[model samples]
Target: MYLKDVPRTDPNIDPATLLQLARDVLETEAEAIRQLAPRLGEPFVQACRLLLACRGRVVVLGMGKSGHVGGKIAATLASTGTPAFFVHPGEAGHGDLGMITPQDVVLALSNSGETSEILLILPMIRRLGVSLIAVTGDPASTLARESDVNLDASVEREACPLGLAPTASTTATLALGDALAVALLHTRGFSRDDFSRSHPGGKLGRRLLLHVADVMVKGERMPTVGHAASLAEALLEITRKGLGMTAVVDADGRAVGVFTDGDLRRVLEKVDNVRTVGIAEVMTQGGVRIGPDLLAAEAAQLMERRRINALLVEDSDGRLVGALNMHTLLDAGVI
Candidate 1:
């Protein structure tokens, strides 16, 4: 496994120097991507516009390392509001070209702008009359010249010591792909819910889709006591419901405030006869409340932000319908 022109590392090079060499590679690649920033101008916008207007999918094509990047770019585009998929140029020559159509847009990647396999497919793509967008290092090469839009993903130098490996250039192309995907996402107003729909098996989907109603203890399971109830009565309800808190409702069975273990502790410190105190006198009035339809993650966020452990769920009529806590959220995997 020898690469031409690559230097053999001196075994004498200390561990510190070896680590520094690795760090330099990362820094060089970062700078290369930084240099790519100014090169993104009208061409990038034109590429996005073409993809946006396409009635069919964005067909990404590349060879070698560029193919790997193209696959990831296609996945990102497809998941982020753009319809796209990658087709290997080698496979395309072997009849996979049928996957593309004139209604689609072709995204071709080649660092040298002269990948033979990609070059081989140019005629078939043109024959189909689909617009071509080239992401390449060479702006004046054959691929660029033939493209309807040429995005300059050129880098000043490769991070490889021999300046041969597809290091910096590949990173820049991936960043450019991400930029395009995010831009399209913004224009299409893609939301967390939409992303959740595409990735329902992931935690992000559960966070966005799980609502308070789905995780809350509703109906008779909810812990409640009248505001006029004594501290002993409120404690009985809280202990019975195992929520560490009980809603203090009014005569209409609508919640007005909440009494928690924390409040009970405070009341005990101030009053010797805790049983004499009414929940209305000690309960927190109109405690931070949420609707049943509120996202469970939002509920968790509110409880986290307010440094509380539980949330009281209320209906449109302001009646206490349910309750949830950190435990409930964790049990439902919404945290």
Candidate 2:
């Protein structure tokens, strides 16, 4: 891929130099975040307190690259139990500032702590009596000085060779935002279940929320045979259902045992007359089973631990309610 515009000065730089520069950029950003850790103090606590006590949403305001970072911070906060949304500082000064209310808290981001767009709305935010939290490199700048709590996101230098881009500064600001979100998540006692609710379309949501019953074969689709049935009948049931196994149930419709292809191999080694042998005589009694309400992920773990490919789902009375094979979990994206 060739570019339309070339500098003509040495566009074909050595690959080794490019790789080293990339490594250096990563190191610089990492060091900036490391330096931000010890700076946590009372201001961080005050910010969390203000957010926790807020009755309305947290309105995040920023400009340029800081706006991008603020949007992500707001999303993380919202997904982790805090109500938040980002408002572009440029848009807010026009008409978006009306979104802010007395009950809402304002979180503003500015690498220079003097972004004109953000500073333009300070008087209106003050009129609303909304608490302001600032994330900035300059603690003494107007935005920081006016904020109720100012978080220092200063870095030693930019990762860019020209030291003109918002590289290390943006990384430090993002890390600080993540720190605040995580602290609030812990303080609010957020759980995996809560996270799953907000992310129901993702793989983690499926693993956490999908249950065995939701994916298991039930009713007429389940393979089962009577305990008094011959080995041939059990094998026929297993073949007809294609689950490689068949549940051996008592006359009362409760599972008494299970017979699988593994059992068939053992039975064939000794008993030549498969039609005359009762399934109960060779079946594994009370095979590993799970309840209908068990999470699919837990069932997957149980199958892996027991070294089995299938499981029976039973109800409170131990009656076979459903059956599931490893393929079921795979299809459901549980494993």
Q: How do the residues 1-335 of candidate 2 rate in per-residue lDDT, one tens digit apiece? A: 11112244876877776676677889989999999989999999999999999999999998999999999999999999999999998998889999999999999999999999988899999999999999999999999999999999999999876677899999999999999999999999999889888888868889989999999999998999998998888888999998889998998999988887887887899997989988889999989899999899999999999998889999888779999989989989987
TM-score (C-alpha) between model 2 and the true structure? 0.94
lDDT of 2: 0.91
lDDT of each model, Cα atoms only? 0.89, 0.91
After superposition, which runs of candidate 1 have C-alpha atoms over 4 Å from their true positions?
Answer: 1-13, 271-278
Q: lDDT by residue for model 1 over 1-335, one digit each (tens)?
A: 11323347655756666677777788988998888878788988898799889999999999999999999999999988898999999999999999998899999999999999999989989999999999999999899999999998888888776788899999999999999999999988998888877777767778978889989998888899986899889989999999888888989988899888888888888888768888888999988799999899999999989999988998898878899889999988887
Best by TM-score: 2
